[model samples]
Target: MERPRRPSFSELPLRKGDPPYSAWGLYGADDELGTMNLITPAVTRAAVAEVKLGVTIPLDLPLDAIAKPFIPSRVPYEHKLLARGYANDDEIRINTQSTSQWDSLRHFPYQSGYLYYNGVTNADISGAEANDKNGIQNIARKGVATRGVLVDWCRYAKRKGIEVSPFERREITIAEIEEIAEECGLEFREGDLFILRTGLVEKYRELSHEEKCAVAERTGAEAAYIGVECNEVSARWFWTRSFAAVATDTLSFEAWPRKNSEGWTWLLHEVFLAGWGMPIGELWDLERVAEKCEEVGRWSFLVTSQPLIIEGGVASPPNAMAVL
Candidate 1:
């Protein structure tokens, strides 16, 4: 039998077929996997070609790296060891999203329905106690082994003499993305995971506690985050390019408490997560991978992420790694 071809852009409104952002019926009515379905067999085969050096590096931050939890609500990771006779067991308690994490299908929404992917209402999430609905656990089985593309915007911007300060809510635009991709001579394909580097994690690690506090104060409402611009152009750009998901080395994928002048609040999240059912990775540790990519003059690689399979869980740390 022949393999199924992915739907094209002309096919809008998923009912006709799979549209640019809507994959509703394309996967199935009961499907919870979302854009991850883009990781087709052909795509996976292509990813293997990137692993020529056999070098591996982790893409996650230390769970307790931050002296203060940026998000006040989340509890810091705690480890407890128990000793019984000569045997000992350990217990680790942490907020799934305290460190590097993939925001699952249930992580965000405008209320229950004003916006949510595939008509997932409040009742749908509530009814499925064990997360028979869209849950992170659903994709945990696959463990996310596929092609990863790094758009080193920070370095690209610096080389171009573009001022990108980590201490401000600077919005990296779509034009920048195009420029960086062109500079790297990379053409993205469907289901490819995008890892955007803005030097956020690097600076955060370098700053003193007082300096960190100053930045947090200086950034104002959302805390100064360097990330992609939140706008329709950017959202459409990502959707049309067929990105499976996007990860960033920043506090939030977009600036915090982010809103465009046009009043599209968290537009990327509203579109990508709430509308398209795509995963969003935040605060990934990309220093080592970035360094490796620079040394090899290559950015794409075989990336893998395995999240904890917790039913009804909102988010989980990305046990993510890159093989080059």
Candidate 2:
């Protein structure tokens, strides 16, 4: 039987700058015809065989850089204690921004309309409790089950004898990612998670405040450990191929001090979260994973990521593992 023609990006009545509703449409007709849900229920039961690769944010980690300033110290001791104790659990703060996290749909809003997922009206996303119930917090709890491909951009750069300083402006293109994958003899598969390691976090931690500021100024973007790029073609490829998620060892999925409209506008976030409803995992610990992959000379592994189940929370620290 002849397959029906796949629709073109322009054919889909999506908002401008919005990522295509079906990434498969970018490849060929029939790409979008496949019946496969990227986020499946099976992921929840997937055995966890790998070590957790998320960073434990220092209790004193500055929240200003990533989020609004935390003012607990300014609050009255009794109220502060009450809030920080999570209603008596002094060990757990009720709202400390300094924690491993993910941004929920409510993190950003478009001037037009639309929350993380398309067709989900803002009215449908109101209220912290309501948003948390249906936001990234819940989606993350389902866990991400798939193979994970680690592309060590730092190692690749080192081999090339090009000292790409994490402190310096670094922007990895999709072509570079593809080349690195090819060099590593890795082949991407459907329902895979691509984790790009750029050695940003290590460098960022070592840099002096002045150095960090200098790097940020030079890049015109905040100092980040890693970021993502698709260059139209790659973006199209990712969408059509059914990747479950894309994460990085950086602060964001894109380069620090982003120069394009995408970051400030949160276009990629919208595309992945709202248009495609895919989750983005950032601030992962990739050094160990990269070293392991290099030692084994293998690039692919089974990846397991399960986020905390906090109803109405926007993001959660991913309990991620990579099993070879």
Candidate 3:
């Protein structure tokens, strides 16, 4: 299906009675794939041209990369070996969000009204009648093969002699994002995955094992990291760019200590995931990919990812890779 031309940020809430800055009903009432609908056949065909070197850069951290998950309640990954006639089979269990993951439309909701994307209610996702509406399976079934634009904020800050502390509340403003895109020679396109490298994984590696575990112990307000500035302006920029999804190396896609939006880490989450049906990826290991981009003097590549096809699942690890 051909997607309609996106309306400007000023012309949001395309449907009457919907929240401001939302694109409800833009795809249709029963739309399961939100912004992902933008990943059309033409877009995928164009992205294939970006695979010049055939070098695939893995974007996922090991399922057990983190000794402890940032959310204390989240269970760490466990692998059990099953032996059968000298061969071994493994049974792995994990909290999808404990590592690199794609937060599906079901993960967050319109904070004010408790509505998910396309008006999916809490009961619609988890109750006696809960179905696969807005489930991660929707994305998995369609798959993701598109162009990915990398905005290396950490590298940009270093070039400008700025100290970027991933352990603190650092904000990358919209202006900075625009500037980085320009410096990286990128032109925003529909269906492009906006990838931000905040150097969080790099900093995480620098911490001692004890420090690493402690980092996960901190919860809520105590967790802080560098990330995109989350507000109406940033939301507008992302919507205008028409990104299929947005990913970051930071724990939170938006800056921590979310002092801007009245304690909400990102008001964009409401407008994007719950309102626009765009996915948000977090805790991606971009260190190596950033190095590869630098080596090739290019910031854009062909990215492919497949989320676990679990019906009614809220999120899943993005088995993602970039081909440059």
Candidate 4:
């Protein structure tokens, strides 16, 4: 079937009192119509498709690696019998400490006093039971369904013979991002989940403690790297375009660990989630997918991601896959 022509933002229908930042401005009146602008007809037909081509790397950091100098030796778990016939799995206990998972709306508090994408408030977010009632756990249950495009920044850097720093140290620019997309023969689609690969996870494990700290401190907030882009500008573009989410192989969505700014506050997390009702994925597995694309000389692939449906939980492991 010939695909529908991509619609313009002004063509979409706007919700009553919806903020100006909503993606509807990019397409037309209907939400589905706006979303269709971001996807190819081929991707829409198949709800679950592969987007990550790389081997799944272990996302958890070893407990010993993060042990503090003066902290007492801490055993991750100690089993106690709660029920005679029912035995608990140790993996469940261990998974609680997992840092590699995605965060649900319950995990963060908006400086503006709103909860998450749904505008649930702090009073609403207070109790565990309250959180369970309205949190990312329920919102994410639909599981991110959309087109995913991989922008291989590392490959672009290599083509230029410039060493791209690990995600912790790198700062990609909007222009550089556009360049990578151009080089890869890919175009940004509205409502698409855009994943940028920086090869940071692999390097994080290899760096010495001092080296890692130095890199982290340098990239904290003000530091800029070759591939890192400004979050505010990116957020504005994404919202205007009607993307469902923005993801990356980097630890934090921004350049690295940094102080929260207006852009980071209002745009990155607040506006996207609370205001626009969009989700953001981070610390994704993308290197292998990029490699596959390079090997096949194909920039396009089918992508799918499923997060655990744990009610009231903050984040879930991304069950992501990619097919060429």
Candidate 5:
């Protein structure tokens, strides 16, 4: 399948009275795949060509890496081994979003209108009947195979002598992201998977057990962390770049406790996951990949991910891999 031309950022909301910059009917009223639709056969083929060294890196953190749930309401993973006469079976229960995950279209919605992508409402997600609209299964069925670009913000920060903490609500501007990509000699392409390494996971590894617990205890406005700015400009940049998906080592892809500056009040979660029907991958394990990119002196690679295929599931762990 060849890629189709999408309307520019300026040509959004496609429908009047919808949220700002929403691509609601771009794919069609009943469209479920969202930006994953951008990953056509040609895009996948181009992505496969990025595999030069045949290095495959796993992008998911261990399921139990975060023993405590950053969101207190979420349950920590539990495991049970069932013993049979000659074999053993294991059963594990997990809060999918507790670890590394992809926030599906059903995960969030436009705050003002309380509607998900294509006007899906809370009732649509939690109604009595079983509805699979905008489920992660759609993404799982399609699978995400595309060219990935690793924007190593940590490396860029070090070289620029900028001091910032991943544990804080520091916002990475779009200009900075463009600069990082330019510095790495990379150009944005439609259907590309934009993977950002903010060193949040690396810093988490340095925290003491007690400190980790304390960090996890933070909730609501207190659970502040570093990530991309969640504003119109940033949203425009992302849409124009035409990234099929985006992942980051931080807890959320956008800055926590979103800052409402310059009249920009909504979170990127609202804009991307809800408005544009884009996926947001968080808590990805990018340490080794970042190092490998630095050593190889190349930033683009082939990336593929298979999301859990739960029919009405909201989110899931991305069984993702990067090939270079």
Candidate 6:
């Protein structure tokens, strides 16, 4: 079968701007779907070969599971029944990013007056007009399914007898991810959904109420989100590898309480989300997926996700599933 055609990786550095990122022109100036363009019909059809076991693993955490907000900016969701005893519907209010969410392009801005993915302005995010500009809905209806790969850093840490802490900012470099891939005998492909498990979610689950409160209080304005390295090395590694999206078992995809150095602070979220139009996901529960991969001697599967079709929304929980 002929492979789906798209712009080559060498075609990147698409924009000549300061951050050196853009796919805006590749799809179109009006394009809301960014790297998602990599997942063509051909890719979707070919992805099925990854499903050999017919087992589906849910990747989303319970909406209300984070009794204590791991991220101070995020607010917990409130649920209310619609009618009375005979009511069959319920209304719920959520912050979209409260749990296991995907950060859309509008989730961040390059600057107050600057543009976002595909040159979308602050007005686009606010729905100044009725157009769907870089919204989560732009990608949802198309279905975000692809070959999903797991990098189980927790298992690797335990095997190496490295003590991993959840309440501290730890940088997982590109070298580490590549090393894990080599050890697992897995190959990364274009448009792959990379799920990185640092075991932060697992560690959080084990924390006592007081411990959780203490951690939250101690890190009042600073959340030591354990995450992937946000340096240029990691940025180049990710872009060059052609992974369409990334989700992590931490609060932020990139290490938080991040020091503003070497432009790393701005580059991670800036380059990935707004600059490159790549989606960032966090708070994914990958415990079972890791266990399954370990048992079956496989770390690659067909992953699928569909965010809520909300217009001009900043973020949404990943309605994600991995099938083996």
Q: Candidate 1: give the clashing pairs.
A: none
Worst 10 residues of 5 by lDDT: 1-10
The C-alpha TM-scores of every prediction are 0.89, 0.68, 0.96, 0.67, 0.97, 0.91
> Which candidate gets the maximum TM-score versus the true structure?
5
Tens-digit lDDT string for candidate 6 (1-324) = 443345444565566763355555666676677778778776777788999999999999998877767666656678987776765788888888878889988887665346788777776556447466778887787779898899999999999898969678888888888899999998988888888999888998898888876666655445577888777777778888777888888888887766555754465777778777889888898999999999999999998999998887778888999999
Q: How many residue pairs clash in each candidate?
A: 0, 15, 0, 28, 0, 1
lDDT of 3 at 261: 61
Q: After superposition, how far is residue 113 of candidate 5 from its true place, in Å?
A: 2.4
Question: lDDT scores for all predictions?
Answer: 0.79, 0.55, 0.89, 0.53, 0.90, 0.80
lDDT of 2 at 172: 81
Q: What is the lDDT, from 0 to 100, of the residue 282 in candidate 1?
A: 90
Ranking by TM-score: 5, 3, 6, 1, 2, 4
True lDDT of residue 50, candidate 2: 28
Candidate of highest lDDT: 5
Can you write out model 5's per-residue Cα lDDT over 1-324, one digit (the tens) per residue? 433568988888888988877899878889988898888899999999999999999999999998687888899999899999699999999999999999999998998878999989888889786478999999999888899999999889889998888988989988899899888899889899999999889889899989988999987777899999888888888998898989999988888877787987888898899888999999999998999999989999999899999997899999999999
Ranking of all predicted structures according to lDDT, beginning with the best and ending with the worst:
5, 3, 6, 1, 2, 4
Tens-digit lDDT track of model 1 for 80-130? 989887899989988887789999887776543453567676666765443
Residue 61 of candidate 2: its Cα lDDT? 25
Residue-wise lDDT of candidate 2 within 1-324, one digit each (tens)?
333344443454234554345232332322211212443444323423322433221211222332221122222112233454545543333232233345554444444465344444566567443433236555554556666778888888788886766654467888788899889888876567777888776666686777655554443333333456533444565666557777776655666554554433444565565555456666566776677778768777766666676665656666676666
**Better lDDT candidate (5, 6):** 5
